[model samples]
Structures are given as structure tokens and as C-alpha cells.
Target chain A: MSPKTACFLVIGNEVLSGRTRDSNTQTLAHALNAQGIILSEVRVIPDIPQRIIDAVTECRARFDMVFTSGGIGPTHDDITTACVAEAFGVALRCHQESYDALNALFPEEAFNQARQKMAWLPEGSTPIKNTVSTAPGFSIGNVHVMAGVPSIFRAMVQWLVPQLEAGAPLTMCSWHAFNVYEGTFAEALTTLQGDFKTIDLGSYPFARDDKHGVALVAKGYDSHAVQEAGRALKSLLTQIGVTPISGEPAP
Target chain B: MSPKTACFLVIGNEVLSGRTRDSNTQTLAHALNAQGIILSEVRVIPDIPQRIIDAVTECRARFDMVFTSGGIGPTHDDITTACVAEAFGVALRCHQESYDALNALFPEEAFNQARQKMAWLPEGSTPIKNTVSTAPGFSIGNVHVMAGVPSIFRAMVQWLVPQLEAGAPLTMCSWHAFNVYEGTFAEALTTLQGDFKTIDLGSYPFARDDKHGVALVAKGYDSHAVQEAGRALKSLLTQIGVTPISGEPAP
Candidate 1:
């Protein structure tokens, strides 16, 4: 059977408007890879309520787990918490433990209306540990809501990935050769893909300041088959009259 | 009036597998912003046919224009052309001009079957110029297909964005201050947002080398409103006892 699937919702106007380049998707991808969960899809949307609600509600039902990043802060533009709650048809409430804990972090008169907003979560939601900031992320049902900050989002993924159900971890073996054109070896790569029923073979070309090459990668759940494919990849590179490196090509 | 909306589809197994970081989305976002088009959403999916067909069909129906990057090459994994054809219910036909142009780039023995595949496009498609590579990208209806490579994708966007309908170009006015917390001034920022009727005001915080600050940006099609918001943003920062710097904070 295939592994369980996960979908990531990157919610914010910054990404959609090109004000920020997102790193959370890459971080989540690697973390899920380690957890053996297939990250089936990712969606980046603006901080609009209807968009967030639609994506959160739709992905939660389609995938095994859903992760949402951004718009969870204590500001006016931050509306992810309310939107997710609306998606689940639940009301937002103050979790006593979270409120008290966060309240203790600030001195009297320091915790304003905005800071207090961070303590409020969806009904019956459980707080995820937040080591970077005082405000904690929350998980309600299969939807995990986390901060938009790269550091906080990464921390939440590290803590949450281990808790999810795992399947067979993906393994990869790759070889690279410089001064080789990809089209010349496309037929061989296609045959290799056909031969290895379980493996997903890929040819990725790279061009440096002067050097050009292709990285032939064999990824699969079966480690032995992936290794055999790696050997074949190196041999193919050698037959093309180029020295083969045993891993990804250098920058 | 709301600007024309666009959506981006990042198609590749490399991005979904965390093997490559995508830069095409940012390129498209900036390009559309210049054209005064609102980038509504972005989706990253693996190179699966069903996913491609579904996204292509769905996005074309929802948004004014759609851009797809990646999976157009001479390799077996490059099946975007065929999938796009299926999405439009059209046959794949070789464009004679493109075929002859690409075929002439290589010697008779070197132009193999794999290399020839790049010339096949969806029926009734228009070719987009690709200066970086010999293979031309294609435009079918409102969906524009481009190469995944950063340079090639950027070139394609530059060539295509001007041909589309022009909207009011998005303009911005921004000011940043040092050592000002976003939450501390959240109430004021919210009030400012309420006052700026025509501008979209945003507050973004940054921390670098033991320094923390917030960048308040005012963006809109109305240039006058954005400039007025910028002055107010500067005054707000000065009122909080921090020196305000014009434009984005130094990295």
C-alpha cells in the first residue's frame, strides 16, 4: 500500500505578493520525507478568510494530515486561527493553560489585546510546543496550525513529524557526470525506469559557471533495487566517456 | 475595481521530493505584480498526469490567466506537453517551424528521438520565445507553459507578461525602524490600516545580528494613498522612539 498523504497550506499575503520567498515548504518536505509520509500537494494562498477556510477544509478531508503555516501571529493581518476554526465549524476559545502560561511571560500591562490573542485557539485544540516564541502552535483534529516564522514552523515540524504514523522511508542513490548532455542518455534513462518497477529514476541537468552535467537519481522504498540502479547509472556515465561521481554534482 | 487575477502551477517531482528549491513562483509573482495582475494562488504538485490535468483545468476556469512551470523537456519524465493536451482535449501536433528550428541546431546523427520530442505542442498553441534554450514554450488559451529552469522561466515570463492585458501596476511605499516590536505597535498599526482606505498596509518584523525591527509597507494601485501611508508609517515609528529608515531594512 502507498504511504499516508500530507498536504501543506502556506497561508499569507507575503508569499502571494512576492514580498517573501518561502522556506517552510522545503522544510516540511524534508521532515515529512523522514517520517515516510507522502507530501502530495502544497498550496500558497493570501490571508483571506474564505481562501483559508476553503483550503483548510478541503485538504483536511482529502489528505491523511494537513499542515498550515503563516498568519497565526498576534496582529491584525493574522487571521489563520479564526479561519481554521471556521473551517471546522468550531468557535475560538481561550485555553486556560495556554493563556496562563503566555500571560506569565509578560509583566503587568505589557500583555496587550494583541498578545492575548495568541493564547486563543479552536475549541478542543491541543497546543504544540513552541521553543522559539512564547505562543504555542495548536493542532485541531488532523489540521496542524503553526507560526509563519521559518524557525518556529521548522521546530513544530520536527516535533510533530515523529508523532504521526510512518510508512516505508524513501531512499535514494545518485551519480553525476560532467560535460554530458541529458538528451544523449534520455533513452537509457527511460529504459532504466522501465526496468526498475519500484524505482523512480530521474535525470536532472545542472550548469555551473562553465561546467554542465546531469545527475541520475534512483529513489524508491526498496534500498537494494535503488543501489543496483545507482551502479547502472555510473556504468552508463562511464560508457559516455565521462568520469562519474558517486553522488550529486558539485556546485 | 479588483485587478485581473492569476494563478501559478509549479509542476515537478523534484520540487515535491525536496530535491530542488523552486524560484519560478517568485519570478512569476514579481512579473505579474508589474503587469498589475493579482497573483491569487500558487500550487506545487508532483509530475503526475491526473494532478496536472486537474490543476490545469481547474485553474484555467477559476483565474483570468494561469502559468505552469517545469516538466517540459526531452526526457521521459517530461510529460507536461501530453498532459496539457489531455487537459484541453486536443491532439499533440508537431509545429513545423519549431521542429525545423530545433532540428537545425543539432547535426543529423545527434538529433535523436528524445531531442525531437521538444517540438511537439498542443494543437493551435502559440510558441513563446525561450532565449536560454532552443525548445520554445507554448501558450494554449489562457494557460502558458514554460520551462522549470530558473533562467528559462524568468525569460519566458518577461516575454509573456507584456503580451497579456495591462492592469493598474502595483506600487509600494515602505519604511522600517530598528528595535521596534510588531506586537507592541499592533494596535496602532491596526488603526493605521483602518485609516488607509485605498492602500493595503502590512507590518513585517525582522531580526538580524541582535537587532529587531518592523517594516511597515503601504501598497496599492493608488500611488498617492501609498505615499501618504508611508509618511504616517514614518511618524508612527518616530512616535515610538525609534529611528525610521526609508524602504526595506538592510539585510
Candidate 2:
């Protein structure tokens, strides 16, 4: 069966401006894979309303599930909630449950309008619980709006994963050899790939510890196919007169 | 002056599979900002033809320039050159200069079809020099194809940046205050943002060394406005009874 697909919309001017390196994409990529869902695409957009609307609308229409990280905070730049509402053509309203949760967590004196903005959500959307902070993320349609903070984004994914339809999980095997060059085995690896059409092969060359080498990875839904490909890859490496190392090389 | 915009298309299955962390995007983001070009969008896509073609076609149409990284290597999975040609409805052909360069760099005995594939480029696309590796990346129209390897990608970008139109460089100033929360300063920061409409303000909260704080960054084309915003942010922090620290907190 074809795996369920997901698209991650990473919203932030900080990432576009080079002020921050995005860790959320990688985190979601790994998590989604573990749940058998394919992360088909990831787009990092700035904190602009129209851009967010465009991305959210496109992703929600294309993928089975859509996730967004960033711009859900209580600041002037945090317009993700409103933009998402605009994308769905819904009005932004204060979610009673979320407002109650925020009130229970924060002191009455500390409950200011800016902080209160966290309770606002697109009409008909439900809240995604945020254990990291009092401010909860919300889900509208198939789209889950999460925090930009890595810790919070990671937590939100852990909560959202079980709710989505899971597909066949992808398994992988790797073989690496030091003092080897990709040009030496490129032809052979290509031939091996043709035979195992179902398995996806990747060649990543690296230079480390004063040695150069390549890591050959085989990944697919079937463990047996992945293993057979790994074996063929090792035999191919042996034919090229190189000793293959199992697993990844030590960094 | 408004900055020229560019969108990055990061094509690789390794990144989407979480097998590798993409450092190329961050490297390019920093370089583009320094050159005054606004990196308006970034899309990380798997090494699939239709997806690559869609992303390439869309980004090329939307932005002033488009840059793609990965899937240009010699391996069987490296289909970027062919897919990019299809995106522009052009034909892929082996560029003579690139072929000659590759031949000169590698031993004649090592030269094979796999290595020869690196010379292929879309019609009318010129080669970008790769100092780290002999394999040349290509640029067709506004799209610049680059290597996935961080070292090679970095070098290729250094060569391409000088060729593009540079915009007014963005400048920024930052203030950090410990033992303060976003709630403590969200109202003040919002009011300050209204006064300095030209400056882009960001509030990044952090917890470190057993203390919580927020980093207020003010960015804009005008250095004077950024300075003014920084001063106002510091004054706001002082009003909240916290002395602001200039620069990032120590790790």
C-alpha cells in the first residue's frame, strides 16, 4: 500500500534571515518515518501572512496530513494562527477550553492580552496540548499548528503522530568502507539498484579521520529486500577489493 | 531598497529520510543574507523527478533566482540534471567544457560512464566551478544547480554569489535579559514594534544556566533604525526591572 504522506510547513523569519538553524524539520522527518508516514515536502517560509496562507493552503490540499512549526508564540511576529484561519476562510475566535487551560496555568495578573492571544484559534479547530508551556497549539482540518521552539515542536509531534493513519514503516541497512572512492563502485552499485527495484539506494561520500570513503544505504518497506540489497552491496564491495564495514562510520 | 529574493530547492532522499542533516541550507542562508539577497523560501524535497520538476518550475517562476542543492552526483540516484531539463522543457546534453574538465582532473583509466554523467547539463546551462571536486555544477536560466556535499556546495555558492544581483544588506542589533519571560515584555515589545514599523522585531525566549530570558532582535535595511529599536528594547527591559545583556548568552 502507498504510505500516507505529510508536508511540514516551517514558518519563521528567524530561519529565513539566517538567525536560526531549523531543527524541527529534521525532528519531524525522523518521527514521521518511524510512524510509517512519508514526509513528502518541507517548506520554510517567513512570518508573512500571505506567504503562510499560500503554503498552508497548498500543503493542506496536497498532503494527507499537514504540520506547521513556528509563529505560534505571543509576539508581534506570531501571525500563524490568524493566517491559517484566513487560509481556511474561517474566523479567528478564542477557544474556550484553551483559554480555560491558559487561565488555570497562569496567574490572573499575568493573563494579559498578548498572552491571551495564545488562546485564539480558527473557528471549528481543536487545540493540540502543549506540555512544555501553558500556550497550546491548535489543529484546523488536517493542519496541526505547533510551536517554533524545538522542544515544544517535538512534543507536539509526539502527541499528533498517533492520531494519523500509519503505513508500512521503512527499514534500512548500510555498508561503509574506508579508503574507498565512489567512482570505483558507481557502476556496480547502479547495476545492483536495477536488480532490486523496490529498494532505494543512496551513496554518500565522506572524508573523515584522514580517510575518504562512501556509505551505501538501502532502504525500503520490506526488511527482506533491504537485507538482500545490503548483502549484494557487501559482495559488490568485496568484488572491488574493499573491506566493508557494517553500520555507519564513527564520527 | 527592496532586496532581490531567491528560493532554495534542497533535493535529496538522505535528508528527507533523516539519514543526513542538511547544512547546505543554513550555509546558503547566511551567505545570501550577507550578499543582501532575501532568501524568501526554502523547500526540501526528496529526489523524485515530478516533485523536483514541480519545485523547480514553481520556484523559478516565483523568485528572482532559484538555487538547488543535491542529486547532482555521479550515482544512479543523481537525476537532477535530467529533471531540471524537463522542468524548463529543454534537452539535456553533455557540456564539452565540463567533460574536458572532468577528464583532466581524474585519471583517464578512472573515467567511466558514471563519472561522464556529471558533464550532462540542460540546454544552454553554463557550468559552475567546483574547487573541492572536479565535477562542475550547472546553472540554467535563473536556477543554479549545486553539489550536495557541504564543502563543495559552499565553494560553488561562493562562485555564484558574485554573479547575482545584490540588494540592500539587512542589519540587526540584539539585547538579552535573564530572569525575564515573554509575558513580562510582550506588551512593551508590541508597542515598540508599532513605533518602529520599518524594523522587524523578533522575540526568542530561552532557558539557560538556571535562568529564563528572551532575546530581542531588531533587523532592517536601516542601521540607525535597528540601533533605535535596540535602545528601546533595552529601556523596556530596564523598566521591567532586568538589566539587558548585549549579545547572546554563553553556552
Candidate 3:
């Protein structure tokens, strides 16, 4: 199956200002990768409405699915929902189901006025159930809108990924050798990468005390081809006078 | 001094495809923070020239300083120099100084052939000397363009930050409590945050061994004010029937 492409729009001033370390990008990348969807881009914009609208429109037009996290809170800076609606040329309206859920989660005095903002949704957007929070995330077109909080974002992504079609996952295998230099293995690695047109070989050099080495990673969609290429890599490394670590091949 | 705001543009198809995990953004964020410049946005766009132009133009207009990483390689995908030139309404041409530096790094045969692309620069842009590599980074107006490789990007940032105007660095202090529930401390923490108008307070809840607690972090430009607010926090926690951990008192 062909790979499906996805993009992530992280809307928050906190993340860009280094006030918040983003865990959502990593979470989305891993989840999408596991589902055989290639996450193609990530853009972190501020709470600006125009910026959010522009990025959302561009990503949705370019990729199979576009996911956005953050800026759904009740604060003045929370404008993602409205911006998204504007991007899709839809009207912003209160989602009754979401409002009812929020109303049920808190006292009438505490939640009535303050939590109503969380229920605001774009016209024709379907709510993506939030198992952790009463404020439900929403989906419109191919764009899935979720929370910025890592835990909530994770839960929402898990709930949403299963509903979409997934492509075949890329298979990857690696071999490691210590006490070797990157320069020593660069030529062979480049040649192998050239020979295997479909496979991508990554050479990662790590620092170690008397144990320096390169981690040769082979990545592609074909499992058998990757394993065969890995064997060839091992043979090449051995011929080049490098010691290979023996282990069961990764699945 | 008001905190200086900066933004980063990471231009690369590799990053967008998740083929490369971005270290450039984090490195710049940390380095800029140390120099008292707050990084306010990071946009990762593909190698498309139009997107690069749009991101650079918009970011430069919004922030005090704009930094761009990636798309400076020798490959055909490297279009940042030309796009940046277009964004600034300048011309793209080979830089003699950079060409000389590249020649010095390698023999003329190797440098003139493969590394010639490194010599291209936006007309009238000043080169930021790269201590690690021959491909010099450059700056035009308030936008600083650096390489994609982590080591070189870091070196360029370190060299570039000191040359720019820096605002006062924000001082950060934290108070941690063990075996205390967030529900118990929520009210007190909220009160403390309101009382400290200058400080930005963040309460992070964590679960440990089935116990709940929070790590209260206070950040601001005034060290004395943070300490004062921290003292009030410890006092409030103690009054709320929680034992203070060692180092709980304001330093």
C-alpha cells in the first residue's frame, strides 16, 4: 500500500516561547508511524488567527490528513477553533453535545459560563470523543483537531487513528559496531544506499569512551529486502575489518 | 528591558517527512534563552521555495529576530539562499569571501566542484563565520540563516547571538512537594499566582507510586520578586497541612 501523508499544526505561543516543551509532536509522529501514515510536516504558530487559518488551509490542501493541537481553551488566545472554521469556510457555533458533556462534568455555577467556550465548534464538524476530558475534540474535513496537553492529545489521537485508513508500514532494521569511525564506513554505506534504490540507509555516529561506532539503519517497506540488505551490510562491515554485534534481528 | 522575541524557520523536506528529528529548533531555543532572547515560533516547511519565502517574510515582520535553519546544503533541494534573497528583494550571487573560505577548507578541486553551492549568498548579506564548516551562514536584516546539521547550526547560533541585542534573561525558580495532592494545593497555588503579578507561575501535576503532587515553577526577570513569591508559596503550602520538603524554603 502507498504511504499516507499527514501534517501537524501546533498552535501555541507557549511552545514557541520555550515556556512549554512540546511532547505532542513526538506523540503524533510515533502514533502516525505505527499506523503506517507518514507525518510529513510540523508547523508551530502563535495564537494568531490568520497564521492558524493559513497553515491549516495549506496543510489540508497538501496532505491526506492534517492534525492540529492546542489553542482550544477558554482564554483570549484560544482562537484555533474559530480560525479552523474560517479556513474551511464554515460558521462557528456551539456544539450542544459538547456543552451537555461539559455541563455534566462540573457544577452549574462553575461550568455554566466559563466552560461553554469549550463547546464552540465549527459548522459540520464532528466531535472526536475525549475519554479524559469532557470538552470533546472535533474533526472537520480530513483535519482532526485535538488538545495541546500531551496526555489528552495522546488519548484523542489513539481514538481517532483507528477511524482512518492506514497504508503499509515501513520496515526498518539496524546493525551496530563499536570502536569504528564514521569515515571508515561512509564509503561502503553510500555505495549500499545507492545499490538499494528503495531502501534508505542512515549512518548515525555516537560518542563513546573507547567504544565509538556507527549505527547503520536500513529502512524500507519490504521486510525480506531489508533483512537481506542488512546481511549484506554485516558482510561488508566484516570485510572492512569492523566487528559486528550479534543479536536477533528486530521485527 | 522588554524580553526580545525571535522565531525559527526550519526549511527541509527531510524534516517534514520525519526522516530527520529536528535538533536545530531546540538548540536555538536553548541558546537564545541563555542570551535573553525568547524564541516565539518555529515553522518547518518543505523545500518548496514559495513556502520558504512566505514563512521568512511573515516571521521577519512579526518577531524582533528571525532565524532560519536548514536548506543550505550542496544538493539541489537547497533553495533557502535564493528564497531568502527573494524575500528581501535582493539578488542571489556567489560570495567571494565564502568561496575563498571554502577553498581554504578543501583543495580547489573538491571545493570548486562539490562545495561551490556553499558560496551562494543573498546580495548585501553578511556571512556568519562557521567555525565547524566552510559553508558560512548569513544574516539579512533581522533574519539569521544557518545550516541544518546540529553541530554546525549550534556553532552558528552561538556566534550569532552575541552579535545581536539581548534583553534581560528571565530567572526561574521551582518548588516541589511530595505526597501532596493537587486538589489540596490547587487553591493555595492559585492564590499565590494571583498575588505575584510579575511572576509567571506554572503548576505541573505528576503521579508517583499512586501519590499525587505538583511542581510549582515561578519565572520572571526579577530574581528578588521570584524569591519573595516563592516564600509565600512555601508558607501557604505549610498552612494547608502539607509538610515542607528540604529546600522548600526560598533560596
Candidate 4:
């Protein structure tokens, strides 16, 4: 299958202001990559309604799917749900099923007061079940709106990813060479990368305990191609007179 | 002292495509928070030259400082230096100091071929010396352009942060209560949060070994105010018959 592309829109003033460190982006990226759905863009915008609407609308048009995190909480700053509704030209109304779920956990009178704001959903959107929180998430078209909390966001990803068609997972292999400078290995790595047109080759240089080394990672969809490239990489490293550490096979 | 605000522009297609996970944001956030410089915003844009220019220009106007990661490499895709030059309306040229450094590291002819691209910097920008690699980073106006690699970015942060003025570091304290659900302590935490106007309180609910609990964190500029809030939180937790686990004092 061809690679499926997606974008993430992280909406929160707290994150922008660095009042909070964002963990959701990394979590989503790992989950999507495991399923072979490439996340192509990530935009962190403020709580401004107009910005959210514009970002959601633009991202939805460009990517196969758009996932948004934050601005669905029970605060004045939480406006993602409404902005998403406006972007999709849908009406914002209370979802009865979500209300029932909230009410089932708490007293109706109290839950109504706390969750009335959360029940607001975009027209024609199906609610994404929230196992971690009373405030349920929803999906409008291909845009999945999930909570900002890491635990809750992770739960939603597990639920949502299986529903979407995933592309072939990329296979990767790495060769680590110690006591080697990046400059020394640059030519060979670059040549290998050029030869392997379908694979992504990355040279990550690191300094540890007064020793410098580079980890060469090769990634592609075809397992045979990846293995072939790995064998070539090992040969290249040996020819360069560097003892490369052959680690366990890449998962 | 008034709060110092900074913004980060992460320029890379690899990060946006989920090909690489970003650790620079968290490292910078924690480090900057310790120095009392608040990170106001972070935008991860692609290698698109126009987008990089737009993000840098806007962030420079909005925040006291702007730090950009990625796009500073020897490859063709590394266009951050050029985009930054365009943003500042300056000509791109090879920095002599960087060229000299590269020449010292490699044969003159070989250095000229590979390091010439890394030497390209925006006119009038001061180079941020990279002790780790030959690729010299630079700072122009209020924007500090650094390498995307985590180690290089981190070294730049350590080198650059001490040169900037920092506001008072915030004092933070936490109180944990185990085996107590958030519902049981929600009202008290909310009430305490309301009473402490100067302090910012965050209630985090966690599940551990089939048990639920809440961790109440209080942060503020004033040490005494944080301590007072912490004491009040501890008393409230005990009053609710929830056993409290006191953590380290606010730093």
C-alpha cells in the first residue's frame, strides 16, 4: 500500500507559552509510525479560535488525515471543538451519548454542570470513546480530536489507529562505528544513501566519555532491500578500517 | 523582574514526517525554565524556505528571543541559513572563521568542498561557535540559528543561555496522595487553587498498581507563597483522610 500521510495540530496556549512541555506529539508519532501512517506536519498554535480553525481547515485539505490535540477541556481557553465545527461547517451541539457516559460516572446534576461543555460536538461527527476521562473525544471527517493529556491521548490513538488503513511499515537496520569521526564516514555514507534511493539513511554523531562515534541508520519498506543495504553498509565500514558493532537486527 | 519570553522554530521535514523524534524541545524547555526564561511558543515547520522565513519573522516580533533548530547541515536540504538570510534581507556568504576551522580539520581541498556549504551564513550574523562539529551555528538579531542534532543544539543552549538575562526562577513544590481518586480530592484542590491567586496549581491523576491517586503541583515566583500553598495542600490532603507523600522542596 502507498504511504498514508497525516498531520498533527497541537493547540494549547500553555504549550506555546512553555508553561507545559508537550509529550503528545512524540507519542502520536511513535504510534503512527508503527502502523506505517506517516505524520507529515506538526503545528503548535495558540488557543485563538481563528488560528485553530484556519490550521484545521488547511491541514485537513493537505493531508489524508488530521489529528488535533488540546483545547477540548472544560475551560474558557478550550475552543478546539468549536473551531473544528466551524472549519467543517458543522453545528456545535451536545452529544447525548457522551452525556450519558459522563452521567453514568457521576451524579447527573453534577455531571451535567461539569460535562455540559464537553458534550458539545460537531454535526455529523462520531464520538471517540475516552477510557481515561469522562470528557469524550470525537472525529469530524478525517480530523480526529483528542485530549491534550498524554495518557488520554495515547488511549485515543490506540482506539483510532486500528480504524484507519495503514501502509507497509518501514524496516530499518543500523551499524554503529566507534572512534570514528562523521567527516571520515561522510563520503561513504552519502554514497550508500545515494545508491539506496528508496531508503532513508541517517548519520547521527555522538560524543561519549571522550569517544566520538556515528550511528548509521537505514530505513525502507522492503525487507530485502533493507538487508541488502545493511550488508553493503557493513562492507563499506570494514573497508574504511573501522570496526563496526553489529547489533541485534532492527525491529 | 519581568518574565523573559522565547520562541522555538523547529525547521525540519524529518521531524514533521515522524522520521525522527525531537528531544531538543524538552531539553531546552527544562533548561530555560531553570534559567527563568519562559519559552513562549514552538512551531515545527518543514524545510520550505518561505515557511521558515515567515515563522522566524513572526516569532522575532512576538518574543524576546527566537531559537531555530534543524536545516543547518552540509546537504542541499539544509536551507535554514539561506532562509534566515532572506528573512533578514541580507545576502548569504561564507563565514571566513568557519572556513578556517574546517580547513584546519580537513585537507584544504576536501574542506573547501564539504565545509563551504556549512560556512554559508547570513551577512552580519555572529557565529555561535560549535565545539562539537565543524558546522558553525549563528545568531542574527534576536533569532539564534542552531543545528538540529540534539547534542549540537544542547551545546549551543549551554553556550548561549548564560549570555542572556534571566528572570527569577519559579519555585515549584508537589504533594502526592495515593489510593485516593481525583473525585475525592477534586473539590479541595480546586478550592485551594482558587485561594492561591499567585500560584499556579496542576492536579495530575495517576493509576498505580490498581490504585488511583492525584499529584498536586504548585508553582510561583515567590518562595514563601509556594511554601504556604504547599502547606495548605498537605493539610487539605490529610483533612480528606488521604495519606500524603511529601516530595522535595521547591527549588
Best by TM-score: 1
DockQ of each: 0.71, 0.72, 0.23, 0.27
Candidate that beats the other on lDDT, 1 or 2, i.e. the better one: 2
> For candidate 1, lDDT tens digit of each residue in A13-105?
888888888888889989888878888898999878999999998899999999999888877888999999999999999988888987898
Compare candidates 2 and 3 on TM-score and give the better one. 2
Given candidate 1, what's the lDDT at residue A198?
86
How far residue A164's Cα lies from its native spot in candidate 3, in Å, is 1.1
Winner on TM-score between 1 and 4 is 1
Off by over 4 Å in 1: none
TM-score computed on alpha carbons, candidate 3: 0.70
Prediction 4 TM-score vs. true: 0.80
Kindly give the number of clashing pairs for every candidate: 0, 0, 1, 1
- In candidate 4, position A239 carries an lDDT of 85
Q: Rank the candidates by lDDT, best first.
A: 2, 1, 4, 3
Backbone clashes in model 2, listed as residue pairs: none
Pick by TM-score: 1 or 3, better one: 1
Tell me the tens digit of each residue's lDDT in model 2 across B1-251: 68889999999988888888788888898889788898999999998899999899989999999999998888888889899999989998989988999889788888888899898888989999999878999888999999988888999999988777887778889899887778767888889999999999899887654667788899988889999998998898899899989966654
